[model samples]
Target: MTKRDIFISLALMCLWGFNFSAIKLGAMQTDPILLTALRFTFAVFPAIFFVRRPPEAIRYLIAYGIVFGLGVWGMMVWSINLGVSAGMAGLLMNMSIIPSLAIGYFLLKEHLTPYKILGAALAIAGLLASITITDGSVPLKALPLTLIAALSWSLMSFVVKQSKTKHVFAFSVWGMFFALFPLVLFVFIFNGTQPFIDLPSQLNSEVWFSILFQAYPTTLLGYWVWNRLTIKYPLSTMAPFTLLTPIFGLIGSIIFFHEDVSVLKLLAFALILSGLAISQWRPKKVEITSAKLKSECK
Candidate 1:
């Protein structure tokens, strides 16, 4: 990648990392479901005028929207509310990569190399270690909810991979539109009568700033840039950069939330990073040729 590409990747990582902090801020003042609904509502506004729908199967687009927007964000917000620290949430969410790879292998029939298998095992082990070190005492009873979020994300990845649409931003925008109704229902079911009617006014400037930051930079702009990057580069090349997001989340948490980072957690982080690197590392040219020949012969 060029220096410019590297800079863009770094900026993307920063945006995602800071997103945890933003979630924390939003959760403090508004109900999680309501907050999630509002975030998407904000995201959909600009796209209404600018983004065009792709000429593809409507089902794929709708499924993508549901999984990516409503399902993932719904569970994630609930998890954050339940007691998953923003930093921890960021770290644990990396677990979605496992399911994504699994889905690709089983459902999509994509190749899974030994390196990827080993990397996945190591990453999972690291996650287990983190859970154990934290005494499995997830706050707000958030583990299950977060796991749902992870699954949603994995499913969304599959949806994106299967989408016939070439325009990523358009898919993202349509996703927001599709998700709005479900998110509204969720908010109604959870928030009841005393909704975030006062949320706008009650939120201090810092919180509102966090909300707008999340809606625009993290949701809209970040997705736009990410879609472009994915189009320009191979998935393997782009996948590793995702690991950087959690690093930013950790740093941001320590700085903003004053979260503790124990030695074990640090060790877990190292193992996870190593696992991700190993998974994404390309094999030698000869090995690639051999694999290709073998597949063709089969």
Candidate 2:
């Protein structure tokens, strides 16, 4: 990555890290599902008018939108509202790697290494530890809901790969159009006409700030740069940077929400990050040392 690109990636990570805080902010004001619906609504229009829809992606668009919007984000916002802290929500979302790897291995015939297996084990241990946290951060029901968010994230990844669309940014933006459907449907079913009827009153400055932040910088601009980076570089190079997200999440949570980080939580963070590091590990180019050169010389 160039210095410019590297800076951009770091910036995106920071925005994404604080994205949880933004979600919590809006979710506090209104039903999270409706908030998420509004998020995609703004994300799609105006921009979607300009970016051409991804070609031959109707089915893919539908599936991706629903999973990406409602399943991944809606559930996530709800989980946070249910009492899962922003820091924990960000960390838990990274667990999507587990399901993503599994889907690749079992369904897509991707190879899995022993390191990945060990890493999965460690991550699972960390997950178990996370659930056992009695610190009022991770509520019992919130655990399963966030797990669903993680799973949905992986499923959307699968949809993207399966579609094999070159226009990732357009696909994402257009797919988000579909995402609005499930989100709107759920919002209606759960809260009826009240939330939408009251929508006019809910558009305070703080709420608008949260919504625009999530929609523009966090979702549209963020994914656009990220997709460009992924296309320019191998997945291996891009993968490790995400490890910083949860770290940033924790830091942001402490600064904004003043969420306490306990000893056990630290252990869980260590185990989970360690596991991810191991799983995401790829072999580096072997530069022969003097000893290795001597053996070859011999």
Candidate 3:
């Protein structure tokens, strides 16, 4: 990768990192599920009409939509609303790698390496440490919800890998389009019609800004740039950069939300991140294909 590409990757990490604060801001004002609906609505509009549909079967697309949208993000936003700190949520969500590895081992007949087993153990320890928090900064109940988001994301990875979709961005747009309907249904079901009926009056510039940030920059641009980089670089080179996202997430949460980090939280962060690094480690001589990298981009 060029210096410029490295910079771009870091910048995207920051964009995604701060997105949690953005989601938190939006969730605090509007209904969480409704806020999610607004996000996918903006994500799908104009762009969805312009983008071509992916070559995958409609069932796969809809499955991607449901898992990506409601299963992953719906639970994430709701967990944040339940008082999980944005930084912690980001870290917890990355634990998806753990489940992905496990699922591959058991269901897909993949090998479970020693490094992966050790990594999983460390991450589990970190998760256990998280349960001790009583300061109310990180809600114990919300932790499980975030873990569910991680599992959903792992499932999404499988979905993307299973389907032979060549158009990454187009597939994502269509997935968002399908995701919008269920989200809207969730809003009406849980939140009632007034939020939607009064939507125009309810939206302020700050809220709109948050929604647009999450929709355009965080979701679309982030995925696009990351995918482009993955296409250009080796998977070994590009994949490691993603580990920085949760670091930036923690930083963003501290900077934007003034979140205080505890000693246990720091230990958990260290264990989880260290385990992630170990799991993602590749032998120095192995080369990976662009197709593999593309499939990994969700």
Model 3 bad stretches (over 4 Å): 1-12, 109-111, 225-243, 282-298
C-alpha lDDT score of every prediction, in listed order: 0.76, 0.80, 0.76
**Which residue pairs collide, candidate 3?**
none
Each prediction's Cα RMSD? 3.7, 3.9, 6.1
Per-residue lDDT of candidate 3, residues 111-222 (tens digit):
6667666766776677557546536756877877788888887777667656656788987888778898888888778878887776777689878988999999988877
Q: Candidate 1's residue-wise lDDT over 44-73, tens digit each?
A: 887668877777688987887688677788
lDDT of 3 at 163: 65
Error of 3 at 266 (Å): 1.9
Residue 107, candidate 3: alpha-carbon lDDT: 63
Ranking by TM-score: 1, 2, 3
Instruction: Let me know the TM-score candidate 1 reaches against the reference structure.
Output: 0.88
Stronger candidate by TM-score (1 vs 3): 1
TM-score of candidate 3 relative to the true fold: 0.82
What are the clashing pairs of model 2?
none
